[model samples]
Target: MDPEKVFHMTGGVGVTSYARNSSLQKKASDMVRHITTDTIQELFIKTTPKSIGVADLGCSSGPNTLTIIKDIVEAVEGSSHKILHPPPEFRVYLNDLPTNDFNSIFKALPEFYRELRQEKSGGSCIPSIFIGGYAGSFYGRLFPNNCLHFVYSSYSLHWLSRVPPALYDEKGGSINKGHVYISESSPPQVSQAYYKQFQEDFTLFLRSRSEELIVGGRMVLIFLGRRGPDHVDRGNCFFWELLSQSFAELIAKGEVEEEKLDSYDVHFYAPSKNEIEDEVRKEGSFGLDRLEMFQIESNNEDQKDDHAGKIISYGAEVARTVRAIQESMICHHFGEGILDHLFEHYGRLVDEEMGIEKIEPITFVIVLRKL
Candidate 1:
């Protein structure tokens, strides 16, 4: 299946929408706000572009995209006070796949602009900020050359441009059977295929951004990553493993076809810090300003509270979080009928895993400067 066509978060302001389930992402972004604002401030002070062009790739629907823009403008405004140069105007671009729910973000802009206007000074707005949406993939060019000054992406980049070509053999059939991602039982070739895809896609991303960003441009990228070199480590792949285990149980009961299970493969990869560094160096268009990996609890703190009798509810919430992001693709591969049952089994597996040990996902905060 073409992921661009089939892949998108569960849209709209429903119970399963990404906007409701994205607290984890918000927490992760909040943890790095200091780093993000600091980078923007420093870049602004140095380059002093008359109009700062900021692109937030993979910015899904709702007011979150506007929140990013607001923070960036605040950061630049803060730095303008320290220098003699006048504050730069803002050109904010929000981008996501065409299938994403762009309307929600658009509907929320009036409120955002009103809030920005309220922060007025001398009967004028703080900065002349313009917001527009660009719908497409980020693995290729999205803007004109030398137009962007700062770029930011959060919780994206792990998705491949396409499924790894090596996943299929000469006959064009899946090799990693009964599993959607690389698991501990997967052969060495399986890991190699995933890594090869990440290498090519990430290189292409850097090249594309290099052309768009001016010299001395800075970008902040935050995404899921693994702490170790092992592909089977419990960073993010383990969640897929739990789903695979659920599929296996369904296959045994004849509720889902084994062939259908084998036919599906997740178009995602989590690379290590060394692997990321290697690709950045090899790409040679950008220099790493800061590369650090941090961990956050997989489940919410409230979910963890009152855990004595809340295992099932806790697991259900976790399943719902993953469901918000992946239900579209899962429903496309398997029939929609399987979602309730499939996630039920998946939730049980999550509860069991959580009972066994704590699950904290490793995330990478990478700051890159155009050379």
Candidate 2:
């Protein structure tokens, strides 16, 4: 699948944008501030230097990116008392896939800069921005070695490009085609191939970032994920599967064609805590400073008396988004007529499944330092 096209459709302006607003950023900022300040103060007895450089890898456009940067500034400021000299200037780099909506990010920057300038103290400080693309992957040689002071990436990097095509080659006779990620019912070999690809991608990421950070520099990653006993099922991105199923149903009903669905695959990985730690260790780059996992409180729960009702309502909304993409061919499949019935079916299924009250838990704020 084309990374640029997928991001434009999903990450450009949709639920992804909503996820990266100022409010979410503020929360992430506070978390990073607390962790970094404590780690720096306790670990490095010496004073910190002025003019710190920070990077937000995979920082898609909007308040979320700015929020993380702001929090880093605050954390540095708050720790000034511990340092003998005045605080340093901040240079922040925002990075993403080439196809990310950089215009939106740029548009939001002036206001973000203004707010920071207004809040500044007497100390001289400069804030700078750099934009670039992480073309192949996030895990290697993106920046000069040992150049950065801090790094953060949120709600991104969980996705990988589609599996290589060779894995799906069919033999002379057997029905075992060399396909990749056909469906949840996809062959175990295909699933394993995708999993191996993610592992390699993540390992490279750790190693690359390890080389980029100064010995004491910090990095944090906050992203959408899941947890379960089984590693294979842990990052259960069922929403995409459901969407695919919906699309298949539409195709069977003559609402769309198989050709349109040809180019896309929902790519995400949800690794267990153990899985993440193991991968990091294997990479041998950074030492894990911290790890924490928590669930974002869903608004549906607070508004409804019946927990089951709330679950159903939330599920229906999720399904609605999926169906909207189908109706509009957002992923380049199906058409508009299927949207109404799509919602109807989704709503019915969710309402019936309310007894399960399923919720997606976001995972892992990992702070790593180059060893």
Candidate 3:
């Protein structure tokens, strides 16, 4: 299946929209803001080009999207002042799949521009900041050669472009049963298929970016990653297991067919640090500067006080986040009717788990410089 056509976060500012349920992502961005700011500042001080090109790939729409742009621009603006150089004109590109909600982002541009003038440019540098949308996969080329000086992506590289073909047998039957992703029940071959796909996709990504970024350009990547070399580490993969248990409950209730569940698989993987380094070493494009593992507070919620409602609200918040992220793919494979039931069950499972022990989601912050 074509990932461009099948994958997208749920759009619009509704109860289930990514725009509304993305606080988890907001927290994630906050966790890595220092790294982002440091990288941008370092790049600006080093290259103060007349027109420095910046691109944010897989930049789904929401306040977080523009907020990141604002932060980067501010970082550059601060650096220019320190170095006593005139502020460089900004040529910013926001990239995502074609089916992403660029319309909402475009409509929100007026306010974004207004704020930029008031806060960033001091009402003078608005025109210097030119923003445009480029819709395509980052697994392929999306910009001109030697054009971009800075590239950033957050919480997106974990998604493979497509399910690995080796996941199926020669007769097109699923090898993984009763689970959407690699789990304890998954065979060792299941993890192998996923690792192979990630290797290919990440190598292609590095090769493509190597041609676009000029020598000494800087890039920051943030995505889900495991702490150890184990492919089936439960520390960061319990949510997926919970999701599979949700489907099992549905099958038990006769709400979903067993055959349908077997055919569906998540096109996502959380690679270990060793695996990521290996792929980058093989690609031979960028130099890895810094790699850090950041863990999110599982109980990051409004009602942190000890109350029954706390767990319920926290579970609901997590379920909402997952629905906003995976709704498109889940609806495509399992139909939209099962979302309410499936997620309700998933939330309960999460609550039970959270009560026992908070399951922190692990993410990696990787800083790269073009060779």
Candidate 4:
């Protein structure tokens, strides 16, 4: 698989754009701070007198990544201050795919270091950034054993390049199908295959983390997830279904090529909380330190007086980003007009749904630690 081709489909632009958005960054930073203060601090209660190393895996380039790193640094600094001996040096590693926007991340590092220098009050050592080169999946060992004190990953995992071939073809050959995600309501085989892949990938992730983390090292993972008891494919995402329907409508009207629409794929998997916990248990090494699940209320309480205008503006941004992603061919097949039509259709669908007072709810945080 070519890195450029893969990233072009569902990689850089969408993730980078999302990460740069102020609201998302703030939310992620706040969540990281809470996790560090509540769980990580407890784990490091005894591992003093030595410097600590922290890592942010799948850390895409942008202010969002920086925001999370800053929060962790601040928390560590606070923890170190209470100790009798002077605090040890802090090493922070930022790891992402080889095709990731590392240039942006490196460019921002000097500013981060400058800020840390200014913030240091006493004999505190400045935090250092080590750019890590971990190509391919983040589900394997990337660091030395027992080296990391804390590991954090957000909005990254839950993506597998392609569904397992075994699920699609029992003989283990390529099926050349459009996307198994579309077979959501169809056969059990399709869903099972995707689930199996997720299981394998997640298991590898745990095993690798187990080797890298110290006995008491901490990890916090946050991502876009769903809240439901029953497993529904909804095409790997409800949002994707809405966009696809929009595209289908345009194809019917001869506005776009069906071939163009059929050639691409969206790589996202939103697991239920139960499914996630089960995977964690299977890993067997890490113990669940803290897990909190909540529905993020999409409706703005302050916009009660200006509901109509606010909804339109909000829907537009969502549509814009979605369209930008589709237009960029990050998924391989979608063309320029397809994204526009998809966004328009999505906006209309959202408007109709809003009329019924339905607000889409996304899930919240989970934090764990090595036992």
**Index of the highest-lDDT prediction:** 3
Model 1 regions more than 4 Å off:
121-124, 298-312
lDDT of 4 by residue, 131-167 (tens): 4435545767788888888888876766654545554
Error in Å for residue 73 of model 1: 0.9
- Global fold similarity of model 1 (TM-score): 0.94
**Decreasing lDDT order of the candidates:** 3, 1, 4, 2
lDDT of 3 by residue, 1-371 (tens): 67789799888888788988788888898999999999989988888888889999999988888899888888888888888898888889999999899988898889998887677455445537788999999999999999999999988999998998898999888999899888987889999999999999999999999999999998999999888877676565778989999999999999999999998998898999899899988898999999999888776344632223343367778888899999999888889999999999988888888878887779998999999
Highest TM-score model number: 3
Those runs of model 4 whose alpha carbons end farther than 4 Å from true positions after fitting are 1-5, 8-16, 25-32, 121-135, 166-184, 233-236, 259-263, 300-312, 320-331, 335-337
lDDT, model 2: 0.58
Residue clash pairs of candidate 2: 50-88, 51-88, 51-89, 139-205, 168-178, 168-179, 169-178
Tens-place lDDT per residue, model 2, 198-313, is 78878888778877877777777776555754433312355445455555666678776665555444455666687788888888878888888865444333232222343235
Q: Which of the predicted structures, 2 or 3, would earn the higher TM-score when compared with the native?
A: 3
Weakest 10 consecutive residues of candidate 4 by summed lDDT: 299-308
Between candidates 3 and 4, name the one with more favorable lDDT.
3
Instruction: Say which prediction, candidate 1 or candidate 3, comes out ahead on TM-score.
Output: 3
How much is the lDDT of residue 115 in candidate 1? 87
- Candidate 4 is scored at a TM of 0.81
